[model samples]
Target: MSQPPPPPPNQPPQGGGFGAPQDPPPGGFGPPTPPAGPPAGPPQQPQPGYGYPQAPPQAPQTPPPAAPAGPPQQPYGYPQGPGAPQGAPQQPPAQPGYGYPGQQPAQPGYGYPGQQPPYGYPQPSTMPMQPQAPQGRRKLNAQAAIIVAAVVAIALIVGGGVMYAKSSDKGDDKDTSAGSGGTEGKNDNEGGEDVGGGGGTEKVPSSTSAKVLFQVPAAEVPKKDVWSVAGSWLTDKVYAKSGVSEVVGYDPDSGKESWTLPLSGLTCAGSPEITKDGVAVVVAEDAKRTKANPYPDCTEVTAFDLDTGKELWTKSVAPGGGEKTAFKEVSITGTTVAAGSGLNGGAAFDISNGKILWQPKVGSCEDVGYAGGEQLVAVRKCGDYGNEKYEVQQLDPKSGTVKWSYKLPDGIDNAKVISTKPVVFGVDSGEITASGATDVFSLDDSGKLRAKITLEDGKYEHDCGVNAVHNCKAIAVGNDKLYVPTKQHEGAKQYSRVNEIVSFSLATGKPTSDRADAGEGYEIFPIRMDGSNVIAYKNGPYDKGSQVVSIDGKSFKETKLLETPATDQVRSAISGMVPKSSEMRYTGGRLFMAEDLISAPYSADEKDYAAIGFGAK
Candidate 1:
């Protein structure tokens, strides 16, 4: 290492470091030279290798080994420091730079580019260097280059921070690359708008104009038969059951005819239930069919592929002598579709081959339906007719054997099952009375009584064409609780007060949220299920009002989701006033749910029909 030329005569070396004092620079160490303009950036690390306050001074020795020849190209990684072109002719070495003993060569400071040296500092040598050993030059250049790289790296990082801060201040996304998810908002279909999916615009309020997916005009089909329409996202089509012995399927996306298959000498015996695999329906052999008695003949079961309109298979089902609708209610599981008859029994048919799977010894006493996910469940009269015992049987689909059975308790006074999931809701005899036993019992998975609730004063059982459990608007499950319509049962305590819509916890049968809504004379009925909430339709005595409410299941908060179908024809269809000729659900879609709003074309006018819509947002 070269000695930093010794300090002039009288002044003691100012502690071995870069600022060591000289004896008055031919005059005196007057004022310390100002660091050329404030530092261009955060303080540079004392020019790496320069002697620190504690570092020992270099021992007197020959000058540092010369840097190798064959000049290295300017580094390509970073923008060059401002001054001369990066590769400009190397200025002669000035003050010695600090580094491993013999590694670094003396060079001008790169800080404050283009600035003159501080007073008393040695001037950069204008003389060119003598050629030296290539190996030695390489070592010297690499060490010096490292110090330059460090300063460059720090500058770039600080620059990046400033850029990001500026972008945020401008209220734009910082990520500027394509598909960087920097856009704000989205179409209604791409919801989460706030919650799920991706970062986008907030969803429009329910009051805003809805983007209609599709609406089928009423004039195309008979007004009375308008409601036979049913839709399913699984099958991706709108389905309708014509009483005249045929089923029509329409594409949900465009409302075009997907396919229409005839029943061949049979009438729709009951409302059909559809699954992605196929559609299950009960029909009557053409014999006893009449305008008044739709299924007066014997029973027949049919399965059709809504995807292709091909008849998968058909089976003759006779629930036995003179029983009504022996093949009425249809449900599907795995590969088997089962149809339950009035009282005779339920028969499971192979969904693919139409072969009978199995028949149970004991048949469901009441209408048979599905329960507990894919299992079949029904209320069956177990004891002799004189004694009359009723129990719910969870049946095995393969052999029709009883998987488990839960019997109704005595004094419960005739509780019939209404829903099988979320919770087992039973409709007991008569409206809620003071002395009456609990008409509604919430049961857990093991069939244990979880909680008991009574009905409201005016919430009596009524036979609404669509849903039989009219006391409650509709059966909706949210946040592990079953929400139902209930009035303050007579003499119940404050904790049990469920005025309009009551939430019964499926696990414990306790009231979780005070989630109920209604205005005078107009009670709220949950008509549709949204994510984890229920969309409610406010129905009063005379007509269906134009208020659509949504209740959050978790919080039990209610928000006006949408205005009721505004068109009179659509309103009439929703109200169920006009006679619907068909018996099917018309509304269907994935991102959206649409329905034929009117039962038929408006007869008073000429040809006009409508439908209502509700969806993701």
Candidate 2:
């Protein structure tokens, strides 16, 4: 046998040398290796302690006996193969372009020396970093958006509500009538049809024929100098010229005579006053024809029905022994009617009947007595001749019992008491000084003075030369405001044009400083306070010429000026020359004025008076 030809290169060695461990050349038994570096690969036997099995020397090599069946064993100096077991199936030798143990594979398009994968194999993809929401930011933005929208919505809603409320309020204040002066039955600019004669005494026009809509004439023969006038709403009539005391009803719209109630045996010196329920209470003297000595002895307090001109009741109040006495001033409020005797204090009566309620003795020569809520305030002159001073006394409305008295300061020539709650007094100097003053005093229920307010200190001076405090002609209180009017002096002539009207706050006693110059030749009478409007007469640029002026009580501004033309007149008659006396009065929604002219026919000596009515336009 030829020595077996030195076993073929790849075959195992013969028998007994199998265990001979002369270290094989680095690559284990094989043909002499070329200089191309030891077989390009990891070492066949792992380093000691690497946990790899030792390889047999001269052992048959069949692809290096595939690495143990399970995961390949870990090599020394390198971490165990990821997910590989201590002993496992060995992976095939890395393909071209693949990496050796512990080495990364070459990128698909790149080559490491000769290592490279076959073309067309896909490379592992790198996943993009997953996007993440900013921490807490999304939730925070959602909340902020909601809050912004809510704020905007609330602002819009509030603004819209305010606008709507303002519009509704404006609509409520608008007046819907044609114009301030539009007449009910006439075209906008056209005047009413003339109904009666232009001048001379023709027949008295009937209500249907009268151009004037509302008028009240003297029910009884008119007095020579009428000082005061009063009206009753229940009866729709007026009591005029006290002493003659005529009660008349005229159409509120046409001024034509409606009815007349005559008081034959009565005379009044003061303005007739009406009760809240519409009864007329007047201080009157017995008719001249009925009693010869009617001055003091026959004086009586009379209550009359406004509707029928019927006397409701009468009560005679005379000093001891039925002595001749005169009751000067009479006033009526809600529940009581009171009269002040010129020299005696006052007496009150039940408004429901004519029964006497109370009679309290006051000082001598009382100027005026006023009836308020449940109290009576009287102004009287005290002391003896020439040195007399005035005093104000408070009395119980129901019992006529004296509550208290206040002695007025000296030098007070004349004084008037206006109201009770916030008592006001208008006192004039006894001297020739043009200065006058108004003093406000607060009083308790028992009549003690609580506070004193002096309204003005100097002479009354205005553009028209009338001093308000000194020459105050009229003072009235309404809606808690005091209205004082002073004569406007134009040189020697006292005219309404120069008249000044001033308002004062009753509670504070401070002048409102609201002054209105009513223009030249117009007199202002504080007629009525309706809501915020004050109704006053703008009388006499001339006798028959008058206008109605409505003032804003709050702003003291003139709002409405209404002109009413008098009926035409004929020439030369005494009546034609004697201008009509126009009077103005106001109620809830209406203003009424009476135009009366005493006429004497030109050719006849006879005298007659014609009355007409003028309604507020």
Candidate 3:
């Protein structure tokens, strides 16, 4: 299939490391744009439903002077009404899908040129509807003579700090050996015992309703810059979140800070996977930011125990004693810690001792990022600028050996690994959708492509972070299926919009008939898989509180797990944490949500929340 080329040689570098970032719309990025072309037919305007944000009100219109009565002249030169004889202002075409109740739908010209988002497609917005942060560093623009030049700038400009900071993995380096030893007191089971998927320790409660346990206030940041707080995780007893320059562990039940693991600088990226024993990895800067170096390179990699808040080891790579190597993301498969970059290549380290296991030399090819869990998968970039190709490879976690590799089609600039075990990933073939994907490809164990599920641009709604491979939201994988939420559409109630969670089979790449509905004013999205079942979140309309539910993988039945308070304060707190851009975890009847980036407040009265936790008895 023909895919969209990356920014032309003359264009500036886009921000995403997986691909390149496109600047968000000026007023703030809204929903995905509708696909190009007209809809099959006009549908009724949809009203804002539960869970979705309401649109801002418009200025009250002043009544035009009474029209002169001459053969019933049209009023104020307005177009004839749809059914009226003439000169009656026609009602605006029903807004696409669900719209803010009583609010005028934004006129066309925002997303793709179209009549409306088709069934199963997303409706674009004219204004910012949700609070979100970019996954990668802010994209900067540049001028170049050709597409190749622009592509090169992508590495130099966007790759910036990361390009200068990759660590050398030469076997003879004394630093490699010196940094491999653990710094903290060692535990007997550190390397010997297996800790499969670290969560799922708490028991489910009988009552599905929940109460807010606590809310963490955000730290005051400089008005000129935003700080990255990109990671959060849940264990049986602790919920860990990234702070300014530390990872704080809070008692899950009381929301009190139990422990803090300080870092050399600001936290940049974190591994989503944790060992059964609560060991995880994060990337930070080698030094704190200063006016001279407003944005320090993220070079420090630390492995720590989440439960005890113990720092096992911290290491940074500086090839040939040059600038320290910086990493944009990290992952763990078994005991191997894999850190990747788009410009300098990638390296794997021993999770137990921080030993340099392997660091591949950068040539025409580089490992851009990795998705780790039961398998360690790398998305490698090869070829030259303007003619680059991407290959997805399954690697041996300990040895960094490529077990198998699958090449993406040419012209496809980016891809994200959604699931490693099932070997499923998404690609933005034409770069036409806001979700950064146009199709999903599923592969067999041998790396043979099985089925391709077309998203048809914005027809389906889902998101995988631009810079990181494993940072996907509103999606779940289980029972040989991939689950995604449909775009919101009109519900049974007047002015109400709702959405549903549907699944696509990995073996066939076709959507199954089953669906879990969010009912009349809610939008349902999957969080993660709990065994064969899917844990989901339902965004409620203004009057109702949001909910967490578990959907049976086979039957598609939903069991309510928890619901937040519907009071205005609680509603604002819970609804403001959108799943697409927020760090969220729901495990063992406990739900935690946090922001990825906290910027200076826009106004004095505006409240800032860093994180919030909820629990059921």
Candidate 4:
């Protein structure tokens, strides 16, 4: 009988095994803190490793120093990354490659006998040595572990799971609406104050200190930002990508014009996120690149004044970063600014002056994230694909040493740090792009599991888009309430179903009060917690009728936020799902929502998109 052959190098399994690593839970957050990081760029299956034919060891000389006087010379017999520059004697798949450090080297093959091929590549010779790893005392065996990780990264890059995960660093842990429940005390509304309902097209007020508006033309704005970050609020202005490789800030109060920082040729890796005082952007120093260089030829990252376009400092990836692939996610908190990419693990820099702080020693193809706050970065290290264990570590943003780590509980999807303060951890049971369940744990920064918010059926499911948590993982910690989503199919029309937002009290881990149901056909998602309210809405491209609904923490009153719709491009981007520019956002006590649904700019003559801003009336 004929049998099937092995998969291509660095390829996912032939079966249905790949899944989104960081899909969020209901309301985007839920019971029990599950480790959360940045969004897993594109879900990929960990590839299978192969082996090389073994060769007899000649003799072991005192292994060379970590940093050889020059690049360590590859012995005439040893194979290296990319297989000895092609056409070299190919190692056969006779024995398993080596694994685990401090172990004897296999009989000079690709790996220990039976070891999977490194990163699923045809038994490449040796794993590329990490430039930053210690040289003097480290043993040759140490490279074995790193070699395995590098192989996994290669698998990730080829598999298309680019970005990994990151956590939001909103401060403080006070819970105002602590206790309340539902019919069984699951939806208690004890915290609802005396605020009356603002429904029926009543105009919602805008703050004098801030406002929201879209930049002209859809082609100009950045494609997206970090999770939940349509735009950033720093100082008195809200900043976002407006033009091609340009960032613009507007006053949050009156929607007045502010400063615009333009990068002629460089591309914004992703939308900029705020640091303590400045906004950080990861862009290429040179727009043009080639195989010798790479896309984002230079991952030159810069920090700029939130109020002015002045440059604060600049930093680039370390030397020897093979591709120096452009960074995709950047974060700034306290005095540290860190960027992550498959090219560089996690590079943390000093915000005061662009100085390299530290970096992780991983392949130039795996995703890493600044997953926690209080100066913490998160990274996920996976073994072979057949094995379902993922090792997650929290590292000091300043020093790349592991402060702590744990094996993600088995039988769950990938896990990453989602929130640093109040340290909420999240785990996915399915892919975010489709339907799945997210289990959240409330753990301290030290990795202690404090609480778990279990749902009615222990999962959040529906017709999820790319990220299941799109509207399911909303955490209202300030109000001591956690919000989750569920769809009730009461009518025949697909739009006739109502998406329910169930609020739970942090004090009891149960529903706090009455669940708020979006009008039929509308799927209301909580964008963020606005002080005493949860800002919820259904943004749809070309669905001119979506509304922003604010549910008060104390009164549980539903206030329909009011705003002006600007342009079709902005409308298309702010449709809530697959936002092209992250146009509609909420920050600094204000909620920004596009009032109209339209198409992307298809014609030469198109109106710039518009949105409405609502705040305390």
Candidate 5:
């Protein structure tokens, strides 16, 4: 996994796990009151850090005879350059290897421990060391833990699940509609018309400010147990969201429920990218849950028309006439739909028909997962349970042949594919950071390593789930660069913290002074790439509402696109839906946030919405 921190504004801070803070419960849409600090002083220039310049040396000063060279008088314990804080207790290095301060080791030999890897790969430590973490970030760790615990306790006692739902509401939603009208084919909306000058057909409205178009209330849960409803997309004619055992299409502007395609079982996985012809696929179980089998295998793949709510095809593969392969994930590349599973290996199918394109031969190696879009990349696992190895292979979409493969180093517990076209991914070695990955790797077209970006613990924020290889958020790759937001820090205003989105060149793996400020009390997170621009979400403060902004990829200038309402009712409804934890989609002057799962609410008065839509007229 490769992602970052907790909530902003009303939400509690995140818990510290793996050096970086893990995701915490949802908080207020506005920032909480920070602790009071010392008296104000003259503002200092920003110090150089990774992807930024190095700090200049102070002029040689004449100290009093016998005076000690005390630490610099900076307040927040944030060290600027190479030197650690003066007089601070010295801490020993955790791992000693190729990457050390001023150590120029020999070129790495790309070989695994016992054999020639499918593709030779150097040891993980050959990567560069991340910049020293700020002590200020360290201090937040303890506070975040305390805040998260308190928030959780309050949720359990008060019986307000939505309040604590901020912490773990990562599940999808169930089917049901309220106050929606209209049916399929009645609307006049047409197909793709890429507006807003980007990759998708997202139109930029004249006014950035927005109003709630409509909302879908949470459906009653069966047996009061959580169920996955994890899929959402925006086509020209419809805004579709997955529900319990069904997929619903709604008019994008009017929020009218147009049509519904019911399913036999729950939707477990969904293709993030829809075809240019308005088609997408989702993985569902073959049968409904029963008393004898509360859990059903996710074995069915269904492709449907996003515009018309028409099912194009539904297919499943039972390898060797054995049990049906239970797939955990699915992705799309061109006309091919790929699904992977650690248990049954992986298989590909034609998007147009239910015909099988290819299926893996029985072997020790299993296709654990895949990341697909401009290309198809599979994450394959081999060896025994305790001692496993992983390989990232770029596969031909139609043929399912490996074009290039890169073997990950030993001791890597997990990895997530960040981008397919540029072949970028993140690796977690446990020794570095616990929250997903500590380093990101970019590969050249030949599958050779290009550059590695070290996400210093607690410095950058992302949400790459522990298991899903393609389920990553708050991170974007475009223009041959990676864009990630920095952890929140003391803002220019009193008792306020802010964060900014920074870019790293994939070619050089260096920070390029490219930063987009999130402003006071606001944190900006990259959602995805639009054309050459970065579509970002800005979490707002108590009185202000969250916003969607378009960041110029080159100039780093921000264009505000959509702003939600700031009223108490609307803010509370929007507060719990963070971009990383929830299924959030924005395009054509509209933004929709849907829950990944749904369950019974704690109290009668509490409102638990399955999805909410907002638009800027």
Candidate 6:
């Protein structure tokens, strides 16, 4: 590039110039002077083409009006353009379009007229500013709705799974056919074919194989009428008794007497019990003696051989006799015999050879009994003045070794032990109230309690006396049912009426029947599983003598069997009597009942009664 030329000297070299003054004074040149007034003449006329009138020369003007204040102007330098005033001095151009000092630069893309270029290059014209969409509110709403729907679906699936699990846990598909008709096991016919549409090919259950082969005619006792009948399965013989103290044996098949053994100085009072081995008879006798010498007046238990009426052994437990005992209750099993007495403590005897096995240390006992299978069970009440309490003990039947013992509640006046297959059921009486209470306890083989069912007198309110056996009555266990006879109070006369029969489910322990209602002055004993039909016996509604009535155990409907004529003598003596097994004996597959009938003579009113038997056909 070519360099520019230097300025002239009169201009003071371009930008450094202070040019010479335009005009000067004429004097010594020390300073300029003003011109005198135009020569006194007519005003100078204007020239034709000059455009302005000229001043007439008088003297030179001083110093060109004394230059304006500030630095002198330079020639060939920057000119004061339109932005600057006409005669004013010019300032330096603001450093190539920069603003004044301390002023901020114009923002990029938006600046004053002539500024340097911005830093970033220009962008493409086709690129839009992109209007910054509103973040798609509709899409966000849709996403939120999807999350909520998924959560609800998961909740519903989990709830359905939980319900299905609960239903499956209950085992709803289990077969319930065994519980039908309140019976257990299967039903079949005799010809090995499924009977009653049961699935099995075997017609009948093996348990029904042994049907009733035959039944003998009912036997009648002589002289005093029949009081009770005891049968021996081992000898196929039946023992019958009347008012007399002798046991008369009859053939079960012929209904004829085989032998009559006289009981010397002893009278039968309670039922006889047979040993589990079916070899002996346990006969209870009440001696003829007064309470002053009640020890000698106590009861005696005699064991006799089943084949011959020969007495094998005798255990005399008399009140105040040596031990001052009064035998109240007696029960015998395979290897043991339990006897409860008034004074002498309850004792166990060896059934093989009549010998005292063991005696518990307790007061005089009232009712003593035994239950359970191989493990012998003994239950008894001790104490006098009706303040009796019960004790349950498990012992070895062969050696009389006490395995365990449990003390019952203080109020229990009486107790009975019931031995079903897997458990021992204890039905006990509460304290000496007028009606008393019944408590049922289920015990394991180890003498531990499993469950309890307590029946209070106030809850059931039976009108029986405190000592009545029918207050809570007896419990009989059958195939699938438990029959409990409960005495409900009808009126003021206590212990004089037949009350109710309550059947409870043996499996579930729930009441199965409506309370069975009985008439006034009647007595009932519900018995089931006697070969074919379930039966119950009812006595009385009699004005004088005893009247006998029977009912179907399953239906609770009544069936009249026999009715004896009424007599005033019998009415004054006997209160009531019901049929019962003499010795837990069954003949020809029929449960033998011992009937205690009052022998009322026409001339004298007597308190004596006879025992007899009625064979169910």
234 Cα displacement, candidate 4 (Å): 6.2
Q: Model 3: per-residue lDDT, tens digit, 1-617?
A: 86533321111122212111222222321222433433344333332111100111232255333434554421111112343234322232244232111222223211122222122212112111221112233211100011232223222211000001011111110000000000001112121111123222223455556776665656666654556676787766577888889998877766668899999888878887777567889998767767886667777889998879999999877665555666777888889999975445688889989999877463677787888877889999887655667788999998888999887644455568888888878865443356655567777787766655545444556776544566667776777887887777766666677778877667554456658889887888877766566777887776787888777666777877778666555555554455445677766566777766655544433444667777664
Measured on C-alpha atoms, candidate 4 has an lDDT of: 0.38
The worst-scoring run of ten residues by lDDT in candidate 5 lies at 177-186
In candidate 1, stretches whose alpha carbon ends up further than 4 angstroms from where it belongs are 1-243, 264-273, 276-295, 319-325, 360-374, 383-387, 409-416, 431-438, 460-473, 486-499, 518-523, 528-531, 538-550, 559-565, 577-617
lDDT of 2: 0.37
lDDT per model vs. reference: 0.36, 0.37, 0.59, 0.38, 0.61, 0.35
lDDT of 4 by residue, 1-617 (tens): 86532211111111221111222111310121222432233222212221222231233355522433643332212334442234422222233111101112223222332322222211113325332223332222221223333233222211011111111122111111111111000111122222234211122444222222322222321111110112333333453333334555555444445777765333434322345444555443344323443223436676776667667766676445544434545665556776665323557788778888865564422334554334454545344333333445556666666776644433332443434445444444332322232344444456544434433222233221111111123333444455655533333343244456665444333344446666655555555454456665554323344456667666666776533233332233333222212234543334443211122222222222323333332
lDDT (0-100) at residue 30 of candidate 4? 16
What ranking emerges by TM-score with the best candidate at the front?
5, 3, 4, 1, 2, 6
Per-model TM-score, in order, reads: 0.51, 0.50, 0.69, 0.54, 0.72, 0.46
Q: Between the candidate structures 3 and 6, which one is better when assessed by lDDT?
A: 3
Between candidates 2 and 6, the one scoring higher on lDDT is 2
Assess the local accuracy of residue 173 in candidate 3 as a C-alpha lDDT between 0 and 100. 6
Identify the runs in model 3 with alpha carbons over 4 angstroms from their true place. Answer: 1-204
Q: What's the alpha carbon RMSD for model 4?
A: 19.2
Please write out the lDDT profile of model 6 over residues 1-617, one tens digit for every residue.
86522210000011111112122112111111322322243222211110000111223334224334665432211122343224422322233110111112112111212222122211212112211113222111211222232222222210000000000010001111111011111211233222222322122222221211111222222222222222222233444332245555554433345666655323433323344333444444344223342213334566665546666777754233333244444445566766554223456676667787765353354335454333456655555443455567776676666677666644334444544233434332323343333444555456554333334433332222122121122344443445555543343354344456555443333345434455666655543333122234444454632333333445555544333233332222122122331222222222232322222221211112222222222
Score candidate 5 by lDDT. Answer: 0.61
Please provide the root mean square deviation of candidate 2 (C-alpha atoms, Å).
Answer: 54.9
* Decoy 3 TM-score against native: 0.69
The lowest-lDDT stretch of 10 consecutive residues in candidate 2 is 158-167
